[model samples]
Each structure stands twice: as structure tokens, then as C-alpha cells.
Target: MQLKLAGLEDIEDVLTLHRKYQIDTILEEDKKDGFVTTNFTREQLTKLIQEEQGLFIARHEEAVMAYVMAASWQYWSVWPIFARMIADLPKLTFAGHTLSTENSYQYGPVCVDKAYRGSGLLEAIFEFAREKMSHRYPVLVTFINQINTRSYRAHTQKLGLVVLAEFEFNNNHYLELAYDTSKSLSLHQSTHGQH
Candidate 1:
């Protein structure tokens, strides 16, 4: 698979993969299979792309296979859930590093094609994103639905993200996870053995 930061031209393929794995599109029986919590619009994506905000995609055979999105605090005004998350950021920390709106970026709603779910492609894509974004931000923060064990394991066990806080929103429980970018790069290298 080819991994790189997404461009405006990639918006359509990114939306395709985003829609395919979204929670609402999957049946209850398939919930255990995987789920994406957010659905981004073309306009929102276009803005992200135009501003050079983070959106990394992995493609194989010229088709999008997965994507990971990272956004700044400004996006909170566009998504209320993010606004809620922003309200709690002041209380969170990881590895002696405190998270602040200026130093951290919201990470997630990452989705991978079901066919490549366990193929180690997710980690590769995340590492690619970290390599690109870590220079601009020291911390990467994200929240995951408590029930999405697949994603929880991937974030905690595979990516070395730590759960720093937990809260409920609209009746759904979520765990806020943080990654110290500098340390994470070392962890990724050691755990994945140079990828």
C-alpha cells in the first residue's frame, strides 16, 4: 500500500471509504466487525484539504484503502462533539506532558477497508501520519467509543496510546486517548521493528 498525506483530489475516495465503514452504515450484527463514529462532509473535507490540515490516506492499486484525520481546535465550531472534547482538554495529560489546545491536535475517526483491517495497515497509516504531523504538534489526542473493542485494542495495544480520561456524550461512553508524539515515534519503531 502507498501511504501519504491526502490532497484535494483524494476527497472522493476518502469519502467513499469513510461512508463504507461508518457505524450507521453497518448492521448491529456487524458492529463487532468495526465502526467509525463520525461522518465528514465534502465541504468539511475540502476545507481541511485546502488548509493543509491533516488527512492521511493509504491506497493500494490506486484505490483508497484507509484514512486517518487530524484536525485543529478550530474544527470544534464545526462539530459539537469536538467542542465538548475541547472543554475537557485542560484536565488531561500523558507521560508528564499536559495537553493544551495549542499543543495538541484532535485525531481520529480513522477508517480502514474491512478487507485490510488486521493486515497491519492501520498501524502503518498511523505511523505515516505521526511522522508528518508530529513536527507541528507534540501531542495527538483522540477519543474512542468504549464498546469498540477493535479500535480500543488497536489504539492502546498496537499504537501505544494511553487513556487519560473518560466521559459520556449523548449517552455514549468515550475514552480520551493521548499520545506523546516524540515518545510515540520511539515506541512505534521498537514495537513495529522499523516498520
Candidate 2:
């Protein structure tokens, strides 16, 4: 597999993988496994690539097997939930720093195709994204729906993200997670040359 920043050409394939596990359209049997709550569009993805350089992907056999989105609070502020998260940033702290828009960025809605779910792909791509974003941000933050036990476990267990807080939004409960970008997950080398 190849891990890299996604280009415009990757939008469709990324969306294809996204729809399979998106909250709105995911198969019922898949919900217990995990699902992405955010919905993105081609134009938004274009901005993510051109503006923030935050769309990361892993490709296997030329197909997008997993994708992770990270970007500044400004880019994400368009969404109400993210706006709320931004407002709460001053109240959150991680790795000896008071989290702020300047020192932190929103990360996630990571969607990994089921075929590649447990093959070390999640950790590899996650580190790939964290490594890339570390240049600009010292902290990475994300949220997982409380109902998404699979995602919460994968992130907290395999990735070691800290549960900083929990909040309710739009009647849904979520766990807020954060990590120090300077810390390495050490899985990048494991995915080498799989492309």
C-alpha cells in the first residue's frame, strides 16, 4: 500500500470508500463495526487538498483502502459540531499545552474499507497522517460517537489516543480524543513497499 496526500484524482475513490461506511448510508450490519458521521463533498475535498493539504490516503492495488481527514479549525468551522469543538478548545489540554486552534487541528472521520480494517492499515495510515500534520500542529484532536465502540476501541486501544472529554451534540453523545503529534505510533515502516 502507498500512503500519501490525496490528490483531486482520488476524490471519487475516497468517496466510494466513504459511502460504504458513512453514518447515513452504511449498511445496518456495519454500524456495530464503525461508521463515519461526517459527510464531505467533492468541493470540500478540493479545499482540503488545496487549502490545508490534509487529506491523507492509503491505496492498495490502486484502490483507496483508507482515508483520514485533518484540517484547521477554520476549515472545519463550517460544521456546527466542529464549531462547538473549537469553542471548547480553550477548555481542553493535551501534552502540557492548552489546546487552541493554532496549536491543534481537528483530525478524523477516518474511514477504512473493511477489507483492510485489521491488517495494520489503520495504525499505518494514522501515523502517516499524524506525521504529516505534525509539521504545523502540535496536537491532533478528534471525536468518535459513543455508539461507535469499534472505533473508540481501535483509537484508544491500538492508537493510544487520550480521552480528553465527552460531550453531547445534536442529541448524540461523543468522546473527544487527542494526541501529541510529536509522538510517533511507529507503524509507518510496517506499511513500506506494500504499494
Candidate 3:
């Protein structure tokens, strides 16, 4: 198995993995069941694939076995820091961070193909992503709905990410965890050659 940054050709497999996780997250409720459903189309993936900001794929024998995607952006008051990141990962750095927007790296849509489940692929993906992201951005953050205990457990096991704040949306609260590159991932070694 090998880990690589995602590209246009890998969108389909990524999408399949994403949809499965999304359904798994919503299986217990009725309207709430299919409520989180997304009709995100192929065109959308095509567009995201072109951005190259935050996405990755783990391939086994040329097929995508797991994937993760996030958007790298800076919020208001972070212009200077954003500039530093741009200079660091110049080729893949984005000039898109805005002062009025919340500066953050949103990670998610990570899924490992079922057949390969429980094999520690998720931790592998996150460790790889954290090293790469920490090198590029100053911080990394992901939000897990308060009720999504399964995901919470998974993240803690892998990244040791824990609650930093809480957010209310649609009358539901989500646990927000923040990762300071220097603090959270300084000692982690890559599971692959990339690091």
C-alpha cells in the first residue's frame, strides 16, 4: 500500500468512500437519517480535485482504499501567518485566506474501504496528513458532532485530538478539536516515505 496526494482520476473512489461514511453517520434517525444526504455530483469532485488544497488517498494495488479531504484557509486577522504558509508550501499554497473568513483547516470525509477495515489505515492517513499539514499550515482542526461518538473515539485514538470548543448548528452541538502543529504532531513519524 502507498499514500499519495489525491488527483482527478481518484475522485470516484474518494466519493464512494465519503458517501459510505456519511450514511454510517446518519443511520439512526428518520428524516435525520437521509437528512445529511448530499447530491454532490461528479462535477463537484472534479472541481475539488483541481484545487489540490486538502485531499489525500491511500492506494493498494492502484485502487483507492481510503481517503481524506480538507480545505486549507486562513481567517480574518491571520494574513501574516497565512503569508508564511504560502512561502512554505509555495506550489500547493493557497492565496485564498481572507480576513473576514474564519481561518482554519477543515478535515474530514475520511473513509477506509470496508474490506480493509480495522487495520489501522485511518490512523495511517491522519498521521500522514498531520505531518504534511503541519509543515504547510500552522494549525489543523476538525469538528465532530457531539453525538458522533464513534468518530470522536477514532480521532482520539489516532491524533489524540480533543475538544477545544463547541459549536451550535441546526440546534445541534458539535465538539471542535484543534491541533497545534507544534504541540500535536511534532513527534509523529510517517508510516510511509513522504515524511
lDDT of 2 at 156: 82
Report the lDDT tens digits of candidate 3 across residue range 1-195.
888888787878776656655653434542232222223467656655676446778998757888776555432113343343333332221234321123446566466776775677877787677667766665566667666566676666556665655656567676666555554342543432222
TM-score of 1: 0.92
Better of 1 and 2 by lDDT: 2
Off by over 4 Å in 3: 24-39, 74-103, 183-195
- The Cα error of candidate 1 at residue 13, in Å, is 0.9
| Alpha carbon lDDT of each predicted model | 0.83, 0.92, 0.58
lDDT of 1 by residue, 34-117 (tens): 799887789889887778568899988768999998878786446778889888878877666666788898888788888897
Over 4 Å off, model 2: 187-195
TM-score of each: 0.92, 0.94, 0.68
Name the best candidate (by TM-score).
Answer: 2
User: Runs in model 1 with CA error above 4 Å?
Assistant: 184-195
What tens-digit string does per-residue lDDT give for candidate 2 at 62-153?
A: 68999999999999999999999999999988999999999999999898999888889999899899999999999999999999999999
| lDDT, residue 54, candidate 2 | 94
